[model samples]
Target chain A: MHDLDVLGVIFILGLTCYAMRAGGYVLAASMRDDGIAARFLRLAPGNLFIAFIVGGCLSGGLAGLVGTMVALVTMAVTAREWVALSAGFGAAIATSAIAP
Target chain B: MTAAGFRRGLVAALPFLLSNGAAGLVMGLTYKGLGLGASHAILFSLLVYSATAQAITLSMWASPLPVAAMVVACIATNSRYLLMGAHLRQLFGGLAPRKILLSLFLLADASWLMTSSDADRNGPDAGYLLGSSIPMAIGWVGGTALAYAAPLATNGPLKLAAALLPTMFIATLLPSQWKNAASPWPWLISAVVALLVSHFVDPSWSMLIGGGCGTLVSMMERTDA
Candidate 1:
């Protein structure tokens, strides 16, 4: 087992994550039931999705990200989730491991 | 709803299973790479499943950076939780506090989207979210085990597998939002903001800002309309 501070560490680590999720929660609450913010909150998934992809693929750099994109394109065409995920993650692990 | 609701939840979670599993698997392998065990990786995923956050936290292992700094950084990065928890109130509006907290842990981009879409389509997916996320929790553990045991750091095919998270998310989320939109504004706005983030922000910090920007844009448009 890890030290007693692992969760503490994770909590600190995950705080930013909690903040983002919480952003939705807090903002959603401050708005009226049928208000504009409420509608915007409802539409958030699309924006968040694009942001997540950009962060994951591009932040990692071009080679793996590009390869990952090819894989995503394949998955989109096929509509096969497992296939694309495998290609993206597999490419990352392999490239990182072999980088010299 | 019927038992088919559970089935539908399963189908909706399929992409998450792959992405989360791959991510959990990668974290496990990273744990091993840093001389930690697969168990460490599994435990982390079981407890905290956020991929970007996990990657940031785990990178602490590869550096001389203070572990304490890593912890603080992760918290800063993940501070968006207030939003996720708050939004969930809409879905689980009248639920007990315990259920709220329980759902809070399972809630993320995938779970939120699945739940929201299900609710929009079926109106309140209290039972469905639980059905969907429990399986996802299991998948994370199992996949973490695979990555830990195999540790596919150099494995080309496996890396490709892990790359699917963002794409899968995009595939499902885009259609759901735009399928109901009356104009091209939302899609166009989302693309421009996402592209700007990709160009300007660190990939790590961009998700939060991009999400925030999108919400802000949508809020203004909705107000003016």
Candidate 2:
């Protein structure tokens, strides 16, 4: 790709993403009406990465599944949020080499 | 601070931390796999301060240009955070400039989701929003360090990491305003898009695009109806 082309993409992208975040919060205030469009975009904490769980299991096998399960259960029981994260993450790597 | 606000910031952020930390582990594994030592992995986690980007970078480290490309790509991928930051500007607005800068460095999609979720769930409280950031940063650093220190010691299936984090996060943003559709759909849509894009697009910017696309399409369809 030409240098100018690359620079243009980067510039546009940086502008777009920054704009999205800024716009999201700023526009959030005037969002008094629950029009269909606003409601759709206002969907909180959009599920961006859950597909990774399925993909990980499909590729990584039972060990990966177990790792996922461990994390889920931990989240359920503790509800502590961040501190409980390592359990499932820890399981994924340890089991990566294991057959099961 | 409301309990839900605290939980919203911490709980909702879990899925993000899981993905990020696990991505960090993958980087660590790759760094070790490359015979480049864990220091590269640790430094990447601490300094570069991104998960999937770091994972891509670990592979590219052998050829430094690729790493540069990865940085460009990843920054573009998660550039939405800039937008998220803009939305968050109101939270720490009254604080001194230094505090806002400190807040900005720790701010990420996951943390912001949690904090906003808290605010939405419990009415706007700038103090709660700021308070939530404290633990959020700790979790990220601690999670990364743990993963970096011992890759094998890392547990959980990638799915669990993926789901659990978002699950907690989505849970925080709950008590919804929209009854017709689920909030988690955006996340689910993004994940599926990431799965597809991971196959074709460069890893850096694909997921964020996927997410933005998901949010936009859903809303556009609603508007058109």
Candidate 3:
């Protein structure tokens, strides 16, 4: 592909992504705040987050599982994100080293 | 746009400088391996600005570059943003549209999650949203450029650890998302469904399908209550 073609593809993909990012917000302007749709929006974030973690763990395998557990426990006990992330990183490395 | 809020958000997001940079480095290497020029690689990161979307595009990359398929895959992988944007509208609906839309350009998963948590505690501040988003963008774009300028030979374990950063970041935020007794059931449902979906279908769709199912269960439980 020519440089111009690559640039075009990137530009189009970028626009597509931005459209998705903005589409819901624009569409939600018509939704009544008290409606079921609004309620679903309110309730979706946590579940979405949990699903993300599960998907991540599944892809990462035992190392990912152990790392996430360590991170969750560290977050619970210390309530510090940096600390938990650090602990999780270390645990993943250790687990990866030991798993195979 | 409050200066104080922006500063707090910027400081809070400093940790991602490392996490995002590491991941971005890996992405940078991948692009380089694909034979993309430094400028093209950096532009891809800046424009697409999504690890998932970019990864998907890279998988489908070819001489002709299937433009239609790439666009479809990008939308599918990033459909979560639609839900996130709707939620943000609920939080900052009254804000000026121009400001919100401009800020949306820098929107990212980590920044959105952090901003939502911040809003729950400090109320909606678009400044903070923008501030938090800037570092993540920098880490990603800058890291991609750096990788092209200076390719780093990464080992297996180190790369694995870097890859886990986003997951770890999400895990840390899990505590704040815990609402009450009702939270567990939905969360468990989301996890199990996500695992099942990832196994059977595409892993990419797992989050949306699992999360959507879990949210439906929560809504039903709420109606019953």
Query: Which is the winner by DockQ between candidate 1 and candidate 2?
Result: 1
lDDT of 3 by residue, A12-100 (tens): 99999899788777887776656776566556666776887887787678999999899999998999876897789789989888885
**The candidate that achieves the highest DockQ relative to the unseen native structure:** 3
Candidate 3: misplaced stretches above 4 Å? A1-13, A24-28, B1-41, B48-100, B108-136, B223-225
Residue range B1-225, candidate 2, lDDT tens digits = 355554555555555555555544444544444444354445444444544334333322332233344445444435455456546655544444444444454555556776677666666554555455555545545554565476353244533344333223323222232243444455567667766776775543454456555656456453422
> Which one is best on lDDT?
3
- First chain of candidate 2, TM-score: 0.56
Lowest-lDDT window of 10 residues in candidate 1 chain B?
A: B164-173
Put down candidate 1 lDDT per residue, A1-100, tens digits, no spaces: 3544554554554454544554555455575656554455455555555555565555456545654565666565665555655555565556666761
What would the per-residue lDDT of candidate 1 be over residues B130-194, giving only the tens digit for each residue? 66776677667777788756626833443343343434334433444454344556545655666
Name the 10 consecutive residues with the lowest summed lDDT in model 2 chain B: B169-178
Q: Tens-digit lDDT track for model 3 on B1-225?
A: 788889989999997888788667767876766678889989999888988677657655777877876776577557668777877888888876666887788789888999999999998887898899989999999888888778464457656655665577668767765652265788899889988887776555666688778878988875422
Q: What stretches of model 2 exceed 4 Å from their correct place? A: A1-47, A73-99, B1-39, B48-84, B92-99, B108-217, B221-225
Measured against the true two-chain complex, the DockQ scores of the candidates, in the order shown, are 0.34, 0.18, 0.48
**Fnat for candidate 1 (0 to 1):** 0.42
Q: Regarding lDDT, does 1 or 3 come out ahead? A: 3
